[model samples]
Target chain A: MICIKNFLTILVTFFLILSCVLTAQEGKALQEDSKNSLISGSRSLQFRISNNLTLTSFEGAMISAKKHFTSNSALRFGLGLDIRSGQEDYGAVEEDDNLFELELIAQYIYYTSPKAPVNLYLGTGPQFTYNRHVQDRNYEETGEDAAWQYDRSWTIGLLATFGVEWFAIENISFFCEYGASIGYQSRYMESTPYQGYQDQETTQFRLSSQTVDFGLSVYF
Target chain B: MSRLKKSVIAALLLVFGILTGTISGQNDMQTTQDQQPGPQLEHTWSFQAGISEYFTLRNFDMVSLSVKRHFSNKSALRLGTWINFWARETSQSEIKNWDGTNADTEIENRYYFAALSLQYITYLSSGKDVKCYLGIGPRIRFEYWKTTYESKSDALTRLGGDSGEIFAGLQSNLGAEYFFTDNISLIAEYGAILDFWGYSDLYNYKNELSSGFRFSLSPLPVNFGVSIYF
Candidate 1:
């Protein structure tokens, strides 16, 4: 836990410095008309750093890329991984108990204005997810240690978002979006945690979004 | 022909017609990977990456990526590399007392591999819109595998170990590719893989076939990718 805090503190501090640098472009060559004229027919690539960095205690990074299809439209894709651990019981002999979640998203975006200093866009797309929980336990009374796990799920659902972006400079922008996602999971499974042991299974519906995401984009 | 036979023949014809339309519509361009975004007619260069899932049950998987520079429609020089990582954890239960209660034992194993290959690729039929490339070359790989076992029953026991092996061998394959656009293509290839059994001397597992060479088919033939020409 201490490690996770320190990591986040350092990352936030680093981004603070980067934000200061990007903000210093206020008096630079960026004009309101420059923003609009560049939006139509021109192509740009974007790099983003987002919420996944501090979203969980497990500690992971989320990065996204967007390729402009036209001045007012683009596509964004992102993937994030979290590998968190817990000794479900401190008394258990085996220590590396873990839960894993992987999230993937592809979104389509359309902007309201092609040539504006600020742009409003509506985005929607499909989100894919895989989550699993596992642990190992030792029964001292029976002189045996067994590995067990409950509920692994793979799910897909539609996600929609509405957002605004301020092109702080000619090629860099900061944006935030409010989104919701709900989807069905094909299987919810439980087993002994052995590589191939199967025990129980069920169907499920997954509500797996945080409702809001804010990030920065640098395009070239 | 009888009415039933005529209906059956018509259904078969419809299926074949749909198949042909789909295939031609998605002509997945496989021209020279070097076909740059220009008016030039040369199909000379390509870059490809592939994902493999042939051994999921064995807890193993791999990714393969490659690039080729074609000198002519018939031949080219290629460089490719791929990485693989596999891990498995399982257990054994001891029913020593023949009771419903038990002691559980566990084992965990992990391995990673990276390979580098260089080869000369030759086209047997380099048609303008469709083609197949055949290649054979020397390949080398770096492998690291590790295993750990833990038992916490009557007598708490924990054990762990690892092994590393470097590999060298020859690989050959035949693949067909089609170009659908100026800069995109879909390709499928399959053929003999490297001689993995040659390492029998290190593990002492293949003494029966020491005097004879062994061959195995490459596991994937359905890898798709985009090509950029320069």
Candidate 2:
């Protein structure tokens, strides 16, 4: 699986780079055409709230800058912040988990036509996440004994997104995106009746999310 | 490679070939469009939420409540909190001395369990109607047992117990959605939870499989939610 994932990653990176070069060449051609001069490009900021069918709920905000390279092509770069909360159940207990995520992204958009208002975007990015788990319980049973316990952890991951943007009004537009990310986490456990267990080693667990988000943005 | 491995590899390669072919087709489309004037900009934004119920298939009956969100159309994050009510009943045989007669004894017990998790979802399809998602995350759980026993003579006894622990795990899901409107859809999902713990000679219990304990459960959950485009 790792091999396959790596292969796909390489393939995607190659294609993405190739597309950027092609788009850049197109931009140069358009610049040479006196009839079609590149218009203005600026910054766009957006906020979105989303839910997974089985994971935690997320709320995020992002600010991005776009530069038009041609009459129909542009490049965008952005930063985002997100907060997540959810709960998990073990046969013996349940704990509530909260996470904070920071991400950076770069994307290239190729406008379909001068007369149309549609563009296809391809983007890749990385995210750093901090997760804290709060285990709430009345008591813990260890065979004949009972006590209290808590758990916490932090993780990091890579993100990739592909989507399309549609502009309905002059300066306002809506966008839908699909994204996937992978992360590895480090965890710790503690107990109230006794000193918490020290660092425990486990496989680099994989954390991933797929989302379909829709939000409105205005270009400044 | 074994036959099974060979078959798996073949299937995978076939899928990859099909995907690359489709992408090449899209590239051709782009080239054709490049000859024309500049391209149009297409954009859309949306928000969605849903609620689901969880049922356990183990010896004991357990139920849970769940809620989730989707940001774009493919990435999903879910936060769920669930409470499990456990119940069991058993019968024992009692012998009466001197007379060859047997009396039946009945016993019952109940327990409470809860779990919380943060999960990330990834969708593989480009289209919204048919989509597959993969998810994984960490989970914390608390379990408590309350037992009440009744004897033939109408005697009652109570046993109180509780346990709390946090485990790391992976979550994977496959789902499909049908849209009745552009902004609203019905979703059905199936997924499983895998939990892992360390090997501890001091903490090992007879009921546990080994010094290292791991457990899995499949929660087939379904929900109906509304998606609003921004």
CA lDDT of each prediction against the hidden true structure = 0.56, 0.48
Model 1, span B92-170: residue lDDT tens: 8866554555677787888888888887888665443445567888777877777776776754344566556565667
Native contact fraction (fnat) of model 1: 0.00
> Ten-residue segment with the worst summed lDDT in candidate 2 chain B?
B54-63
Q: Indicate the DockQ of the complex predicted as candidate 2.
A: 0.02
Q: Which sections of candidate 2 miss by over 4 Å? A: A1-40, A49-115, A132-152, A193-209, B1-230
Candidate with maximal DockQ: 2
The true-versus-predicted C-alpha distance at residue A150 of model 2, in Å, is: 6.3
Native contacts, share recovered per candidate: 0.00, 0.00
What TM-score number comes out for model 1?
A: 0.34
Listed models, DockQ each: 0.01, 0.02
Cα lDDT tens digits for candidate 2, A10-114: 566556656775687677655444222124453343333224323221222234445667646666555444344444434354344444445455556555553
TM-score of each: 0.34, 0.29
Q: Write the per-residue lDDT of candidate 1 for residues A141-163, one digit (tens) a residue.
A: 46475655566788888888887
In the range B36-128, model 2's lDDT, one tens digit per residue, is: 432111233434445433421211001243445666555767565666777888776766564656656676666666776666766554332
Model 1 DockQ reads 0.01
C-alpha lDDT (0 to 100) for residue B205 of candidate 1: 24
